[model samples]
Target: MSQTSHFTKVNRRDLLSAGAALIGAAATGLAFEPKASAEKPSTGATHTEPSATAPNYAPPIVQIQGGQLRGYRDGKTTVFLGIPYATAERFELPKPVPPWQGIKSAQSWGPVCPIPPMAHVGIDEFVFPHRYWVEDEHCQILNIWTQSTSASAKKPVMVWLHGGGFTNGSAMEAYAYDGKNLSEFGDVVVVSLNHRLNILGTLDLSAYGPEYAQSRYTGTADILAALQWVQANIAQFGGDPGSVTLFGQSGGGSKAARMLHTPSAKGLFHKVVTQSGGGEVLADQDPAALLKIQQQIAAQTLANLNLTGSDISKLKTIPYLDLITAGQAALRSVAQANNQRAGWNVIADDNYILRQFCDWSSDIPQMSGSVFSEMSSNYVKSIDKNSWTPQQVNEHLTAEFGDKKDAIAAAFKTSFPRKQVQDVLFFARPNTRALAAKAQAGHASVYNYLFVYEYPVNGGTTSFHTAEIAFVFHNLTEPQVRVATGDASEGYALQDKVSRAWINFAYTGNPSQPGLDWKPFSDADPQTMVFDTVSECRNIHAKELIALLPPPPAPRF
Candidate 1:
């Protein structure tokens, strides 16, 4: 925990010197040359260069630790797709991939980690266009988009973690995750990656033997390994390794929060951003309880597969699909017996990740926020938004809030007088206040924001889960984004403002941009930036409402 043990701080002077040395090396024959542009080949491949107008177009190639990679070009950005950072055996720590002899074509996305199909879920179903991909265990790959391929560029780095809890989701699960626009617009290096998940990543075997002592945290360790790789090699892609920021949404946000307390992830990143997935007090699990759950699932899985304890090693060799099916069956069995839902995912374990949500004395700056309405109105079907009555809203509120419905409704209406009853019903005040309270208690500088941008889809789902993604990445023109937000001109304007704030945060710890004066959250006022059409900072604590609500759920892991 000592500061001396953290990564040596690389000052501006050191970065300049390193950049100068890289340029000098490149002047000689030490560094590889940029690939020469060529005309379209007769093969007519998808990655072929355009020959008529942009005849001089050629993908930029960079030399990494493993080998040379030829990445495609997108206007000002150079994108290296499907670059492997690490490899691992089933349920084991990741190891750096062996260096190759020749250039590797990094032109397309790599296979994603196998995840159960969840398109039937309404939220995912809406974003289904971005979900399909070839899934495989060779999923430990990263995608990078940089404005400069020169090592001397020294741009700030931003690594994105995808948001499918520990169980599902991939780096490119959503079109909003694409880094081309963000990297180009911010003039910063953007990176995202895929890692093991579900049973393959989080199955805890430490109770069985010392060899598996770290099993509970392999998924997180894979992220650590990716960060380590970034620290060592990102400079080659014009990134300043010393100024890296870890940012994510939903599950990815929780992972980012986990890294804040993880010893291995210490110093690998300088700043953190958690959107919607910030408060997971239950991230860590009691070892005995976790072991019991794992054992129960293991027994059921083995019985289903007609295998005994002696065939344990064979579990690793089973088809990935079969493993998922067995894991699901075991989880259902355990959940039924224990009268609770069960999952095989990241456990605090108290080894890699300490048993704390936020460390008051830690120096890492953090930014956490949730959408204005997440999973609130999405559950309602066939409801007439235009003809809905206030009585209907009150009835639904009574059903959800019980005896305190009127008190909560009155408080919410007082704060946002213009908002509809449905809007008041789905307001994310409770969870957002809880997250802000945790962040304010920490010693580090903490900023909170509420994404209030309403999507013009599904009869206007206002700031629903994942709605802020397109704006954050400045990807309003993406296909799925257009489907979600019609007439994207307004969305584009908001995207510019929001993405600039994010870029500013990555560059410096402060997220304040030109027109936006984003103040840090304080325990007294608890200010939050309301990211709406006119974006303004506001205090969000309806003290009476918050006090009436039950205490936030306890850590469940």
Candidate 2:
């Protein structure tokens, strides 16, 4: 079946014109309404409304394993915010949240996990506004959005994990992370959550004692706890525990990939969609190598605290922030000696955490892809859009790609005949190729896509990292998304198309929609769905280009 049958062919001229108009609209801060035909799906099951017994003004209430909780209504969706899923101490495994008293209010977002502030600012701050809430150790919370509060509704659930490596990021960091629109539009339950990060989550202290055996994977444990909560309580929120789908972008994507190998996470989620971050196999470390690093960190921190002992129990008594400072210092010292970045992260402990690589052989279906230009354009200096010339583009590409500059540029132009010179310089396919190869190796169905829709922000930025998020969430109307995507009618149309593909994948493990017949990826025929103004499937799009470039480094945890 031809995927192009449902899409109207979009020529280069139309795309450029629309992009220019989009940039103009963004400059003037204007909004555009989606066409009536593109507003909502006509064939999918309709989302259920609030129960007749629920009163307006008063929030809807639901009973869970712990106690009764109140949640608010935002238009057609019911939102339950900041529900505690688990609790844990510093460097310890997560435990289920204790039951609370009657009628607890889940009105506001919970505290975000502690991390360093964003020092290097970029357009990302505007695109994904950082939400500043209370920060503490007791921040293992989850949020839910559903169209129906009835236990019998049985809608498919999408659990979102935020991206920031293993260090920093919150469930509510990005406006695109909002679940209301996605819940209402897809008639499915949407979930997002917060868990421990950095040293608090992944400090390897197993050599100290068996109590800390799983401490290196506390963040993942927290996620497992959250899924367990969903399995036990999500029925009341209109979600199907049996049909949960795990989806995430960037670091979150890596986590989702890792979860596939986790023994405890086996039946928790049946499907996975990893966006731009889950392609590589996590390298295993020698037990002694990790122990050496941890021991170095411990020595420095202990001396800084004016204490002397191998006993790690004393660390629990130090002030949280103070311990973090000491840990950072120790990490830097060890990293300098090892000549690598200093930070705590997941390790293949070989006992409690055994999944060293994503098991594509499992029955869990997978869909993974990267943006067209992942972080390639972020290095470009701030210059007037009109001032950018072909010479400048060539110079930048030559500097970045060296001898392969000409070949890379030619391949990009051949692939995208209508793209601007600046856009061509930022064309990247290594990550996409890597992910496709990994997915193809898996036994279960694997679908791949290249998000080719460029958002005309500050004149134009190709499909950069994180740009496909708003579209997946069906949140093109948000101000930040508007700034990046412009008020183009085509943008909204694409949102409906892409978001529906995701919703469809969650529903049936197939991303095929009304007009698009997405095919599974394989080594012999590397079919990849290119999502643009007019989406289509293209086979082996990056084969030649990837061959010319150096192979990417192995996937790291």
Candidate 3:
């Protein structure tokens, strides 16, 4: 374990300048506006705005025989954004997006991928900075936040995938995905992308007919195509294509896990970071089940719309939003009949995503873990406050555990004696235990952490699952958003520490490069880094919890 001395200090001036380079002359795209009160966070580092006009902003053209992408200079670095990697006919499957004649401005964020509207949601699940109306099917766009416009910069590159449970999310939605702070701090290029999701991406319709077969894993396919684009053109944006790292949280982590085992994704990315959102490999279920669901939905759509053969094509031609509404209704019917969870999950596919991914390959480095008691906060808020009681807890436990009630209750009792049996059993204990076991079992170098910084915004409990995201992006003090934890100097330092560790991991395969002595997962010793007022990387007892559940049965032939 190295000490913290190896971590480099990031100049605030460089980060602000990199952020300013994202806007352009185009009115419809990103427009840089300086904030009035730039009172820096109590860290003593003040905010400095970029120069309105950078006379020395010498940008370069990335010459692709078939494609054109924009790039520009910033304080000895170059940045590119919104470069099209592939095109889709109807946002279902990705194909080669036709090349442009002149240089396409990769200056602003791209159009958002198609997803359910988030404006009316009560459960505050997904969060990002920019949200755009879905305007076209060619939503397979990728952005580059780089350090240099020239190939000579050759910095490590990181590609981020936003998570929304594969149902409702856009890469453009959260402000934390910004590359300025990270790119400047680590001297790396960062990319965030948009791709097909939900019914638009995964409907398992392919088992239904020829049209449907192309629909399954479309989101994963979109990601592969984006990686292909990175391999060919990231150098133009001053990035090292060979050193690309794929990272995401929540739903995005779920996707990255699947990609780890995917044949199509082989050799596309060298490193992976799974933050608080992985290890729930799908339980064995009938493959034919999805096809059946799709067929039932198709039938329902035709009947409800009162349409014959001629109207069927019109149904397909209807806007993406209308199709989404019809799909939601169809899914509701299936869920009612089968008792499905609210969000459709990443299914194991023999063709696209192999079951081998679940087996834990040792070839790569994996960072996997969860927030402390992630599901509890949501569980507490979901139940009717007036009707909440111990009896209600018992009833809920019985409903969830069924025949396994004794086992579940006993496990919860031992793990969280101070808390209610229902909260601990149903939410926190199972998840954290599950994640740690899965990551440890894999052959790859594994790093685990528990995010426990409780935010005052969430009534002063340790951090929640998604709370670490914005802070990891170095956006904790932004006025538009509040950190779930209180505004304290310790909290800020923890943010910097964790975020730096992430950047360090992107730069090198290990989280502790020059500064910290971070240890990877081993069969003999399972260590986890605990993030709180003071961070410590050490091991805790997990064997008892793991023994509570039988080993996951081998995958069926």
Candidate 4:
């Protein structure tokens, strides 16, 4: 199978164009991940959060390397929030926290790492609800939910990296990110954390000095540090560090997949699952070329601040908006100048975190996929496709597929008998299947999936980006039920199957369950587990339909 072309070496204009599509993809769900940084956290005094969910006043104390800490209890799960894993100075790699003399509070969610906000994708809260937190530059923290705190319980640990590219997003950015339900439902430990991102995290200043050599990679370094902390201390929290699974969506997923190639990341995580975002990270690009792009952005940011690289130290005290705004302008200028799609992605320049490709062997079990209609739902959000008359559907299909509309419709119907004719207009990106193919080709055993579960919302446009997250987390329910997925009963049933498969995959490196016999994807036997109302495995065949349809329009990055 030929690899899907995403960020191929194109003219500078084409590069920026690609960024628009990718950023749109991320916005829809995968890349729908960024926002600008808020004003820098008050620096004179220690930052404090407004009253939120604080740790319980008593009980649930668990001691680790940092100090003794207390978390609250919720239902069957023992929940811990805002636990610091490491700390760092601006634009530097993280450092170990010194042990405190007294028990620290792990009750309230910690401050989120500040990020320069990106363009919004006009997502309705009804589809993907978001949660914002107080922002701080010193946000190196984590949250945990588990059934037990005993070291001997040894449950599988699922550490989530947030989306928002390396630009914006926090551990607590979304409502579905709450790990309590997934933790309790799967009988596994769930951990999510905040880290450095965007300009602060990925700006390359190594061109000027060694102190900032790893600055561009620090966003990832924060994650790597968190994993190291988990391996070292999770045993005390009833998690088997040896069984850690690093999974994420969009930017988070892309970053998690990128970790596979980092020399320091081995053994820290045993399994990997990336949904709808890893394809951008695995593109084979010249690291040196990326380095030049990053340097240009950083230099531009510096000039925007009216300071040269020699005064880079002043960046530590710059306001979040000043820094972010400068950086954002730098990105746009560089994007236009180079006409090259530039990213805040780490320029694989060091041994700490390598620029990623197929950095896996058969030893690491993996799963990677995209939503069935990753961008289709986002594109057609304003139109009510399901209710469209046959003529209307044909008109739309004709407008999109031109003379090839009939062939495409026939192929789509033949390929998806259960699907409505309009579904041919909302096809999954070839990149999703391409991502799975890359994983299979790069590793020994890789489980693949295509999330086809039509969300019962907006007349079954449920297969949009980020739709499956509610299911994977077992979170689609109640009052807001119809907003996310209609037919609560069917949604509930599918959640059980989807969430359990994730839990099983992390628990034993196999996603197969009693009825859904998931087989590893391979060249000789390519198969993908289609997750929907009736989850089942099928051969890879979306290619025919994708081939016949017009190329998908570039999504707004």
Candidate 5:
């Protein structure tokens, strides 16, 4: 690994400016990359960024494991997009990219793994805008943002895994997924990748052939391949391959935690953070039985396609949509028969992943958290939570929670004394205590957070799903961010605190900073960072509330 000789310092103001450029580019739906440059980089030198008010086209080029490639510049951070990390056939292990004859143009995005056609953008985009690309099966690609392309500038690498369960979503799906700002903010190399998803990556074809021998998780395999690529080439992109932090939200969080139980991913990452998605998946049942059910689903998928074991080769050429639709139908049939919900689940047949992520001992510092409002009472449409009369609160809570409404209301009042009675309808559920305890038992320190910041939209959505992403990315300058959090100076200050906490966590194991002193969470002292204008550590009421209601529904993709 190369050593750092010259450093380009990025202070908080510079960080904020870098992040501001990111969202505007994302909001306009334009690719943030510029034309590739053929110029080679100086080994070690003080590199200054161009002014943000103008577009400075100082494209950067670097040599990596595959070969020489080129990237572009956006103010302080340099960027490279659509770099092919690996390639794989339908339901096969990822194969590393071969050495190329010449420089590959990484200015544009590569094809995304094929998923069901997405519906038109809804109101959700108002909170989290998106970027779309064409789809393909061989979609093993990665993107990079860094302070320099010099081999000697070894910055920390933060790899992001995207959400959409194991079924949908790509690295470039969300505007907030942009990395240039975060890279500058933390002075680290930011990476995000595109991997296989849904049935194409999880079909249990191993029973019919040896190539598919691993228990149904080729989607995660694609991610593992991306990590391997980072280990081999990130240093050339000014990243410290050994100092990697795997972080993601929703399904992406589960993906990051999944790496904890994966033996192969052991040295690829040094730390992890999961937002709003952790401990939802665990392998506590018999591994053999899990594999058995998976194989049954695979067989049914074959039957739906009118193919037999001898005709397994036909799967490669089948239309992508026809294949996925049939696979989903087969999964539903099998899951329903077993009195289980339909979804593709990997068996713990692989010894490396025998239980929930982080259930075993390790020094790896981890953070897990969720928003206060994963589901809004606005979904009910019958009650105006913002203007509920005292009688309405009583009548509505009774209808929503039945006879336990009184108990739930009291618990809500005790937990959130300042919040309105209607807020209980959307606050976070008590679900992470078990995971915290499990990790603590193994001697691992885990930090928890609850984002209750209210967005300005709809008289204050308070805290909807994915509300914290922009704040954590320090992307409040985006017009959409203004729509979500309003033009409050406090929003800027909150972004600084939140984004800094994440950056500090990436550098050290702990997220504590000068302003906010965060603490690790465990069952004995369930301390949580309740993020808002007045953020503080407190014991929560979600546990008391959970006892008053029925079990929460299974996750949806």
Candidate 6:
């Protein structure tokens, strides 16, 4: 079973050209500053124009931690961007980024971290609209938004991590990820960040050199470092450090789950929300089997490039383009050999990554759920050009489930009789139940949901994996969605109800919104909020579905 070659499967040069076009749109004008020299709150400050650079952008300059900070007022909310938390070295583990001089304008969003674009392959569920552009090592930064008109309204903080499968994506992708809506709508301060990824972030080489020893989990370490920075500096931006909530969708949820058990992130956050995401708990193979492939790739890269010394500095000096080319080649080789899962996955490195990620936070309260047809429906959209037959769907089921193929296929056939074979093959029979089951096992005050508000596509494509993101961010009419779904406001009312529920959940442990009251999951009923054209809470997946899905293993961390 060879790994799919997403790299060479597409034309690299053409993809890079498309990538360059995306980078042009990535630049945004927002900013933030450290809060060293704090300023007292002025309740009724007039909105006056500052200098030429900040004509329409007028925010009170607050001093905290020996640094002056400025925030811009947009409508009823104040927004900030590009706040530096930690400074990372070129291809080095993240360290404390030094404080800057004077008032640093956090008015514009910073550059995104680097990754190659999978352009040849058409868009799928996870491919966001942002450019897959690469940037410098100084890419570690955060964005902030607050609804407090005064500088003294200490609001609860919601820290977000953008999902790109630990490879590509940033905090500045869509306006939906922006803090303005969350801050104003929920009356809470929102913060998002961009961190290292792919080979630059997750190439384990500890078995080779001491320099590589401390660099095993560089990507996760970068996230932990970012959280630590928030703890030290969020209070300056009118955020409560003691009441920070960490949440994300898809890859972001996976990162959040990893942080839940990470020793370094013990007290950094108090609440967790994982939507349509799970950690690396699949019980197929051991992590060490994949790690060996990464070490071999690194060794081959050094030897082929003729770098004898073990110092990473020499490796760092290599040109960016060359590194990308070599990394792609390494990935292709791994895929062809079917060594393990593709390159740069989180490995269980004894210290940082204790065990396969499982839901073991029974002691603490947690909220978890996924879209009803997350991976299943997304697969249908991915292979729209080709049609699949029932035999084809059954064959795929055999491949994916091995000994349990017949039961899984039968379940999908019985559950969705009229669905296309592609839908049955991809979305109708995925591991969505496993995600909810894993979380429920931990006794964490867990809640679940099935986002069923189908985005009305022309033919019969329903709401897919990422359909709720734009709505949750209060950007139902965003440029991206408008382009995809012609009828933009079809799900507007549903969006309003669901987004508010998410914000309310972030504030209190419950998803108790103004008009909607969602019950938390329990042993007797396992309450789930099904967000359709009209929202309601109930166990949509019947007892048969639950019985078909096996129970998840308890977390070992």
Best TM-score among the predictions, by candidate number = 4
Q: Candidate 6: deviation at residue 394, Å?
A: 17
lDDT value, candidate 1, whole model: 0.77
Q: Which is better, 3 or 6, measured by TM-score? A: 6
Root-mean-square deviation of every model: 11.8, 14.5, 11.9, 13.6, 10.5, 11.1
Per-model C-alpha lDDT, please? 0.77, 0.78, 0.65, 0.79, 0.78, 0.65
Model 5 TM-score, all chains together: 0.85
For residues 87-150, what per-residue lDDT tens digits would candidate 5 score against the true structure? 7777888888888988888887777877766666655666667777778887889999999777
Off by over 4 Å in 4: 1-57, 117-121, 281-283, 355-360, 378-380, 432-443, 478-483, 554-557
184, model 5: CA deviation in Å?
Answer: 1.9
TM-score of each: 0.84, 0.83, 0.74, 0.86, 0.85, 0.76
Candidate 2: where is the Cα deviation over 4 Å?
1-55, 118-123, 283-295, 355-361, 378-380, 383-387, 390-405, 432-442, 549-557
How well does candidate 4 score on lDDT at residue 392? Answer: 91
TM-score of 1: 0.84
Ranking by TM-score: 4, 5, 1, 2, 6, 3
Question: lDDT tens string, model 1, 12-77?
Answer: 578998788788878895864443577554576556545755612555778888889888877777
Cα RMSD (Å) between model 3 and the true structure?
11.9
Among residues 3 or more apart in sequence or in different chains, the pairs in candidate 2 whose N, CA or C atoms overlap within 3 Å are: none
Name every residue pair that clashes in candidate 1. Answer: none
Residue-level error in angstroms, candidate 5, position 44:
47
Q: List the residue pairs that clash in candidate 5.
A: 454-462
